[model samples]
Target chain A: MDNFSFQNPTKLIFGEGQIAKIANEIPKDKKVLVIYGGGSIKRNGVYEQISAALEGHQWSEFSGIEPNPSFHTALKAVEQIKAEGVEYLLAVGGGSVADATKFIAAAACFDGDPWSILSEGARIRAALPLAVVLTLPATGSESNPNGVMTNYETQEKLAFYGRQLFPKFAVLDPTLTYSLPAKQVANGIVDAYVHTVEQYLTYPVGADLQDRFAEGILRTLVDNGPKALSEPKNYTVRANVMLSATMALNGLIGSGVPQDWATHFIGHELTALHGLDHGQTLAVILPAVMAEKREQKHEKLLQYAKEVWNISSGTESDRIDRAIDETRAFFESLGIATRLSDYGVTEQDIPAMIAALSEHKMTALGEHGDITPEVSAAILKRCL
Target chain B: MDNFSFQNPTKLIFGEGQIAKIANEIPKDKKVLVIYGGGSIKRNGVYEQISAALEGHQWSEFSGIEPNPSFHTALKAVEQIKAEGVEYLLAVGGGSVADATKFIAAAACFDGDPWSILSEGARIRAALPLAVVLTLPATGSESNPNGVMTNYETQEKLAFYGRQLFPKFAVLDPTLTYSLPAKQVANGIVDAYVHTVEQYLTYPVGADLQDRFAEGILRTLVDNGPKALSEPKNYTVRANVMLSATMALNGLIGSGVPQDWATHFIGHELTALHGLDHGQTLAVILPAVMAEKREQKHEKLLQYAKEVWNISSGTESDRIDRAIDETRAFFESLGIATRLSDYGVTEQDIPAMIAALSEHKMTALGEHGDITPEVSAAILKRCL
Candidate 1:
């Protein structure tokens, strides 16, 4: 295992009715700023639950954070935060809302232009404290400090992270997700699965416990992701999926381990260019990357096949292919298109995505930092 | 899964040469108090590393924290903290020393009798900040806020926990454990294994991630634990073992799951009465406890039999018995006898141990609180 230092201080309040805990988690004296995407919370019971929990608390609301939260909109929230002097942020929807809240929190407190914090890798010295009422379980942003936001004008997607943005508390009531659409649930499952693979399926790091933890998240998603879609109201299935997503990217599985995030970096390019949902981009790109870089990640791919896919009897190359096939199939089963053509993308589009990678200086990616723009183009071509 | 809230804030600095980070982790202005066990760190060259790190920092030293960490001895450290007004503590040895430092950190700021805090469940409202240089891998007290210390005068062992008592940082330099005796290595393995099983081998609670995490820790220990004894200097093996022990009881596995620490509760009694090592007591008693509660814990036992021990080809009763047998055999292979009689704990010692349980009010233990004193006695009788 490599040398690493880790510390995550997000307190998770998880169960059926943990939303009511917002009353206790947030400070009584603080003026709260609640953030969410669209009006889903209002359509569901989450808004009413938050209203009831923070009944008399002094607070304001910022709606329409949007999926794949954009900085153009989050800047507005940051402006409101500064104008109203919002002391605390309550992110009350899915990961995008939480991501927006984190972005706003950082921007509100940043001494300089906060856009540079994402685009230029600026340091976040301090940010407003935030707590989460996670109605969506796609991104583990509720617990993790890092979040990705898009720049609509530049059509660029980027991520920013610091110790300052970790939620002070995260309330995960799986029942709140019962009202979510089947598509969103499927997206969540794929999102979490890819997150686990990003941290895992890289190299043998002697991080046995971390490997098991990563696989455990994968297995949990494989077993319950479909069940969550089929029976949205099943508390047990939703609870497992919800918890797995939180654990997937909460920094536990990646600690002291060699994590390959080539898929995510490449997938972000696709998301930026094609406006695909984050998980759909992942579903389109990961198998191609896995196939292209099979030799570099051969041993772990075999382990993933035997342990996660239960395909131990095949030849090495065959097992890797089967694992990738099973992965694409899993995403397809969720009503997602794993091939670029299925999503209406052609081989002609590969160069532009590869150019975007070059503009972003994405020459070195993955655990070995060898996923050059050429390699990325090859992976994208295979996706076609 | 049950409703649960969880948070652990201990910064884990893990790898070789991490000891030098103490200067950065602790406050520069605070007068530090360094604590450790009987000169082992000194002999292992850990002392030189710690001393070099504390070169420019103002610090005092306290030594001689025993194996189980005596509260009476820790009280003296509390007196020194009060006298010197030590603002922070640095525990440089194993879990016992860290446990003692926790006691001292809590007791120094405590208002009422500190013993009442242990025996009377006095609330801990404040504590001095502390960091650890962990030389042992048995107890996960480094990452967790809980600690167990023996009251030597009362012949009682008790645990104290509060959010305030968590270490600010824990430096896990795997090389520090390289000098440990083979016996200590075996004990660390058993201690970590039982800790995982205590949280795992009760009943399935829909906590698939947690169960897999527990099994992951168990599998790591099973695979590399013996290698830690044989090839003491193997960094990969020791790192896996060290990391496994920390993760085993750091609340990740136990979260939202009904944990069965009845074995630990019963095992502590044997430690207090017969002076056996904590891990030895666990090894001696856990198989018997599994046997005794086979009916109540049937489902989880079957799962454990298949997943952990791979003993699936038998009748339900036979598989459970075989699982228990495999557990005992694993401990025995560690060169630690798995029966109480081998440790000179005969059936005659059962009555006094039962009295200890009654004295400690451990009448109801296990996940379902079904391990009554009578049930515990029966388990002990079988161990004999």
Candidate 2:
């Protein structure tokens, strides 16, 4: 195990009727700005819960935060924060809304142009206190300090993180997710699964607890993701998936370990250039990354094959192949097609992806920084 | 899956040589009190690390906190805090020092007699801020708000908890345990194992991730505990066990599950009466609790049998029995005897233990409040 420091201070208010508890979490004195994506919370009854919870506090609303959480849309919310004197932020939708809220929180308090926070890696001195009413379980944004946003002008997706961005509290009422469309539910599952494996699947670090935790999350997602779609209102299934997603990227499993995020960075480029859904991009890219990096990740792949997929009866090469195939099959079973051609990406599109990787200085990726632009292009060709 | 609100705010500064970072976690303005047990830290060079970390801070020392930390000893520290106007506390030893510091932190701010804080469950409105430099990893007091303190005058051991008691931060350097005696290391392993099972080994609520996490902690301890005894300076083994011990009782596994602390409650009586170490009492009592409550915990015991002990391919009853026996053997392998008689307790001592449980109002224990005094007596008889 490697040396690490870990702390996540998000108070997770989970299970049924937890939305109401946010009333006690956010102070009555703060003027709140409730942020949401495309008014889904309004249709799903989450808006009412937020309204009721914030009844005692002075508050306003910001709707139309999009998936991928565009940098321009978040800048508008930051402007609104300054205009309305918003002291606290309440994100009321899924990862997109929460991600936007994180950016808006920091951008509102930032001294200069906020885009530089993402593009130039500007230091974040402060941020508005933020909380979340998590209606979606993907991205694990509710409990983590990470946020990814797209700059429509530059057509680039980038992540920014700081200690100040951790949410003060997160309301995760899995019941709130009952009305989600099946495609979105599948996307959530695939996103969480890839999140877990990205931190895992890199190399062995002898971090036993972290490895087991990563495996536990993967196993939970595999078992609960399908049930969540087939029986949308099954509280047990929904709760398990919701909690698993939060735990997947909440700094627990990834701590004191080397993490390979080459797939995510490549997937982000796909999302930026082609407008693929984040989860869809991950499904298209991850199996290819697994195959291309097999030699580097050989030992961990065998362990993953055994512990997660229960495939122990094969030559080492056969087991690795079976694990990757099982992973792609799992995503396909969730109605997510794994092949890039299945989504109409071709040899023609590969060059743009490679160029995007180079432009963003993502030429060297993966845990060992060995996934150069050429290697990423080869992985993309495998996806083809 | 139960409705639950969970938060643990203790910043875990983990890894080797992370002690110096505490200088940043603590405010330089506060008058600090460094608390520790009977100078194990002094002999182990942990004291030098802590002293070096607090070099610029105004700090004083309070020593002689014993195992099963006495309330009287903590009270003396509270008085010292009052006299010196100490505004912050830094517990520098293991669970005992941390537990004692918790009581002292709360008692110093209480309006009246501090004993009521333990005896009468006084409402704690405030507490002095505290942090920890954890030289011992057994009790998980570093990352959790819960603490156990013994009222030596009353011959009673009890637990107390409050939101205010959560440590501000914890410095977990696994290397700190390198010089510990084999008995203490073995005791730490048993303590952490029992902690994991107390939260688990109850009825399942479809809490797959929780179950997996509990099993992960148990597996890590089982794999790493003996190695810790033999290869005391092996960083990976020490780190895994240290991290597992902290994760065992940090309120994560027990958050949404039914927890059977009956073993712990029963163990406390044995300790309060016969003066067994906390870990020894757990080793002596847990298998008996499993035997006594086998019917109620049937499903989970089977799961535990297969997952942690890998005892499949037997009748369910056979599996449960084998699992219980394996648990006892594991403890014995650690040089901690698994029977009450092994500790010199006889049938004559059972009544005193039962009387102590009754005196502490622990007549009904375990997850479902089903372990009555009679059931506890049965468990004690099984132990004998």
Give DockQ for candidates 1 onward, in order. Answer: 0.88, 0.89
Q: In candidate 1, residue A352 scores what lDDT? A: 93
Task: Estimate how well candidate 2 is docked, as a DockQ score.
Answer: 0.89
The digit string of per-residue lDDT tens for model 2 on A285-334 reads 99999999999999999999999998999799999999999999999989
Among incorrect, acceptable, medium and high, the docking class of model 2 is high
Fnat for each model: 0.85, 0.87
Give each model a TM-score: 0.98, 0.98
For residues A163-189, what per-residue lDDT tens digits would candidate 1 score against the true structure? 999999999999999988888889889
User: DockQ for the candidate 1 complex?
Assistant: 0.88
TM-score of each candidate's B chain against the true B chain: 0.97, 0.97
Off by over 4 Å in 1: none
User: For each candidate, what is the lDDT?
Assistant: 0.89, 0.90
Alpha-carbon runs more than 4 Å astray in model 2: none
